[model samples]
Target: MMNHKKILGIVLLVAVSISGLFAAESANTENTVKKSTIIYTIKGNAEETYYTMMDKPIKALGYRLPDPRKHVNQVYKEQYGSTTLEVLSFMTIVNDKKVKPLLEIDPKLAGFNPFNLVIYKHQGKDETVISHLTADAIIEMLGITDQKVITEYRKQMEELDALVAKTFPSAVVSHGTYEGAVENAMMHYEITFDRPEDLDDYIDEIQEKVDDTFTEKGYIMAGFFDYKQGKPDLLPSYDAFWTFSLCHFPYSYTVFDNEGAMPEVAVFAPCTMYMYIKKDTNTLVIGMPRLANWNRFFTMNNSKRMDFLNKLDKDIPATFLEIGAIEVK
Candidate 1:
């Protein structure tokens, strides 16, 4: 027979143990939502090294080094006021042959087809950083579950990493992954437009509308791609397909500059969006990878960031409507 006090003590001990267990479980859940990045830090001037790398061709890597955009000086200064920061948006489309199977399985991969890489440093800083999304991150974000496809993506990524290592032999390559709360990995917005008398004219009209809308909202139209003009054999089977890169510098600066926000988030920068018309169909389809994904994928709990992103998410679809796009319920 136990005393009343002893029984009470036992009950208290059990309650405490249960509480600790729940706390630990919550912590483990948070840890699994992290995202990883591969970072290369160079000791020389960022702009000088960036231009040198850009000028060099990467034929050995199966793609030519495309021209890099000078975003900091050209776009950011106009929006964020003048600053010494220098940022470059470097892109290179993987060999179409290499990504054919993946595309066959999922056409959405085209949104990220020409991979985006970023390099940045303030003029005064002695160190420059080169960063891009890891192949693992891309696969996860793309929601690819096929083990075979995942393996191939990893192989390609490793090859690209090896090349980067060779290019910056002396630079330090490090990794960073976000270990915070995870939210919806991908947010998609889509709308359908009635086919006009002239397809080309309609596309131009939509493009002009997107340009005007995003610009009005303090964003930059970083780049555009006419997929129909790409390799016919390896590309998607769309009758008329196109994609564009859009970036809001101030929004970008807030995320990249904040220590709380994972810098690796830039891997998804300059939002890659798509629009297309199906063969024999008069409907034009337009869509974008939602921008709020930044907070969700990175597990950013900051209320202010979430508020801004929420507004952006709404604004994007609103832009579509403003351009006479009908929401594809």
Candidate 2:
């Protein structure tokens, strides 16, 4: 009985080995030769096309440009004529613990309008181009013409320029200080312009008007900081105007304590002027954080401020990632 049992066990072990060999061969054959088929469709306007190519894949999918009438909208009557273009893009990675394929399509793309489409799989850091299509024909179907279209477009740009000018303006502030026995009060005014040429004329006219206003109030110009002009690499170019003043007081000692402490600090103020010109619809842009600081007095007071501002201004025109021009009504 013991001998018979040993023979049966040996036969069972051999059969298991043979089954394992056959399963391994089948897996190798399946992996060695495999094929797949994929299909895709493309759609969008010129603006959409620009974004699809330039911006990050994911971010571009969600962004939507404002309605052309509400904002600025520019159209060319001639094919491939000079036209403004804006592009925006961003990407996000999925890192959940589940085991999934290397690449997955975003469901948001199904509902939103995108100008172009590229469906490709990436194997090892390399991209495999599976399918692609351009939606240029869709843009042409809009049928934009040059005659009445160009005139209306210019009107929109003018309206947009006026709106921006009214929104942002240059101004000044007044502060009081105690310098020993003297109670001194100062007024700081700032003026900014869109173009460098506009700066000179605007400042000149403003200075004349301001001098007359302060003259009646017995306010004399104590010091003037010459227009320190420099464009930061990544900011807009605008002239900054700064001036200081000191008003005469009749009873300086009586206004202060006998301890030589000055008192009765009164701010005798006048004009806070800001002049801005819209040079061209295409030229105005505030691209960087530092550019926003150009008119900020706290940031502009440093000795290195002009250098930094100019460097930023010069670099901004190139650093602008997305830009658009629209005619506003």
Candidate lDDT values, in order: 0.66, 0.26
Q: Evaluate model 2: give its lDDT.
A: 0.26
In model 2, what is the error at residue 245, expressed in angstroms? 2.9
- Kindly give the stretch of ten consecutive residues in candidate 2 with the minimal lDDT sum: 94-103
Residue 192's lDDT within candidate 1 is: 62
lDDT of 2 by residue, 269-294 (tens): 10111122222321322211223222
TM-score of each: 0.73, 0.20
Candidate 1 C-alpha lDDT tens digits along 1-329: 99999999999999999999999999897677454678899886666655555554445556543334556444545656654555544454454446656655665665565666677665566887887777766666666678877787788778777877777888898876766543445444454657777677767887888898889988878777766664444344556776777777677766655335334566677777767666657666665666755655565557766777788888877777777677753
Candidate 1 regions exceeding 4 Å error are: 1-35, 64-67, 71-81, 84-97, 122-124, 179-183, 193-198, 230-236, 254-265, 297-306, 324-329
For all candidates, the clash counts are 2, 29
